[model samples]
Target: MVHKEVADHIRSWRFIVLLALIVLTFITSMYVSLRNIKPAVSNISDPDHLFLYLKLLTTTDNTIPPFHVFISFLGPLLGISLGFDAINAEKNNGTLIRLMAQPVYRDNLLLSKFTGAMVIIATLFISLCLLMLGGGLLLTGVRIEPQELLRIATFIVFTIVYVSFWLALAILLSIQFKQAATSALTAIGVWLFFTVFYPIVVNLVIRAFLPDPSFLSRDEIAGYNEMILNILRVAPGQLYADATTTLLMPSVRSLGPLTMEQLAGAIPTPLPFKESLLIVWPQVSGLLAATVVCFAFSYYLFMRREIRS
Candidate 1:
């Protein structure tokens, strides 16, 4: 069943289009980063060029944003496209009922859809990372450090989990809505809300609450800023951005606003791989929890759903 689903997705036009968009964005972003590679390396003082490879992915030129930024914005689209019709399409074509009539368990059927989609997503991300590494080395003539390569590997893993959250959400919508079009539009609507409008709305709300920051004390203003930052982190996009920033930019020591005391003796240096992972562990856990919740709810609903049609 997983094999059949994988083959079907490979042949699907939706998959083809999404894959093309990712590839185009990735190549464009890498090209932009490569153009600025000289500045990126020269600005740093590390003898080993510890993050030369990471700079390739995170540094941006005038034309395009960083590769991680592109993934943060568009990765959910791939998940939604792959999963928005997973169950409803099967039911719409009458194949779902036929498949259920076989000896296969319902658990197996739903699990197959998610597993197949994940396999495809993982393969796409791995290939893109390798492509960026090869291009970065060839274009810049720099060697990647062992730690830097580990950070890239970690980023790819985080990306997979981040995207899987959306995939699960889309599948849950598919389970809830009988029409594929309905599920697809609803998923995209949610994505747009989080990706584009959510930040605007958050800022507006914060402004309404603190219209006169000048009236507040310094500590009060700092508190308000921290509060606003926390509110923004409610969006998955923000969480992914924070996590990826910490991973890709070794100089990022903390995700939150730092006090003067905390920065008093701080040196400007990249963090070790272990410390970077520690900083982003909460964000990673949140993403994983959200993904599991969506999938579990979808599984429950799918099992209880009536399939007369």
Candidate 2:
């Protein structure tokens, strides 16, 4: 069943379009990053070039943002596109009923759909990462260090989990809504809200509550900023962004606002791979929890849902 679903996704036009857009964005970002990397590399010493390859993968040029930025933006779209119709389309075509009639369990069927989608997504991301690494190596001639490779590997895993959360959400929507169009639009609307409008809305709410920032003390202002950052982290997009930023740019030491005392005696150097992971572990856990909750809800609802042609 998993194999069949995987093949179906591969042949689908939606998959084709999503893959094309991602590949195009990645190539464009890499091209722009490579162009600006030369000057930066020339200024840095050889010994200090640790994780330079990783930097190339994520450094933004004048026009284009980093490749990981593109991933953070488009990853949800890929998930939503693949999963919005997973079960509803089966039911629409009268296949869900037929498939359920076979010896296969309903749980297995739903799991197959999710697993198949995950497999495809993982393969696509791994391939893209390898491609980006190759391109970075060829263009910059910087060798990837062991620590850099570990960080990149962790980034890929985090990305998969982050995208899987959307995939699970779309699957849950697909189970709840009988119409494919309804599920698709609802998924896209949720994505747009979290990605584009959520930050604006957050700022407005924070302003309404805090009124004037000038009236607040330094410590109070720092508290407010920390509170706002925490509120934004509730969104999965923000969590992914924070995690990727920490992972890709090891120079990032904290996710929240840091005070002068906290910054005192801090070395201006990239963190080791383990330290980077420790910094983003909470974000990673959040993404994992979100994914599990969505999938569990879908599984429960799917099992209880009345199936009819």
Candidate 3:
């Protein structure tokens, strides 16, 4: 079942279009990164700027956003396209009824499709990373350090996890809505909400409660900033941006507000990989929890659903 689903996705027109967009983005962003890297590197005195390979992902030329930014926006759309019709379209075409009529268990059927989508996502990203690295090597003539490679690999894995949460949500919508179009639009609507409007809405709400710096003590102002940061982190986009940035750019020392005392003796150096992971563990955990919740809810709904034409 997983194999069949994988093959179908590869052959689907949606997959082909999304793949083109992703590759195009890769070319554009990397070209910009490679073209300007030398001058940018020469000018910047930041210690972490020594990670030239990482800059391939994090650098921007004031035209296109970097590779990571493209992924953050496109990743959810890819997941949604693959999953928004996973159940409903099959049902509309009578495939779900026919498949359920077989000896296969519903659990196996549903879970297999999810696994297939994930397999495709993982493969797509791993291949893209390798391709990007090869291109970076050719263009820059720089040897990738072991740690830089590991950080890129970690960033890819986090991206998969981040995207899977959207996939699960799309699947849940598919099961909820009978029409595939309805599911797809609803999923896209959710995506736009989080990606575009949710942050604005959250910020407006936070401003209502924002402590005035004039009245608040220094520690109190710091505490308010920390609280506001946590509120913003509730959006998956924020969580993903924070996590991926920490992974790709090692100079990010903290995910939240820190007091002057916390920064008093701190040196501006790239964090150890272990420390970087530790800093973003909460964001990682939040993403995983969201994925699990959405997938589990969809599984429950799917298991009890009555298959019909």
CA lDDT scores, all candidates in order: 0.89, 0.88, 0.90
Worst 10 residues of 2 by lDDT: 41-50
Candidate 3 total steric clashes: 0
Superior candidate under lDDT, 1 versus 2 = 1
- Candidate 3 off by > 4 Å: none
Best by TM-score: 3
Per-residue alpha-carbon lDDT of model 2 for 54-97, expressed as tens digits? 76776665577788888888999999988999989999999888
Give the best candidate by lDDT: 3
Cα lDDT tens digits, model 1, 1-309, are: 889989999999989998999999988887787787778778756432457888888777667788898898789999999899999998999998898888999899999999999999999999999988888777767777898889999999999999999999999999999999999999999999988899999999778878587788767777788888888888899989999999888888998777777789988887888998999998999999999999999999999999877
The worst-scoring run of ten residues by lDDT in candidate 3 lies at: 39-48
Question: TM-scores across all candidates?
Answer: 0.95, 0.96, 0.97
* RMSD to the hidden true structure, all candidates: 1.7, 1.8, 1.3
At residue 47, give the lDDT of candidate 3: 71
Residue 288 of candidate 3: its Cα lDDT? Answer: 98
Residue 185 in model 2: lDDT: 97
Alpha-carbon error at 232 in model 3, in Å? 1.4
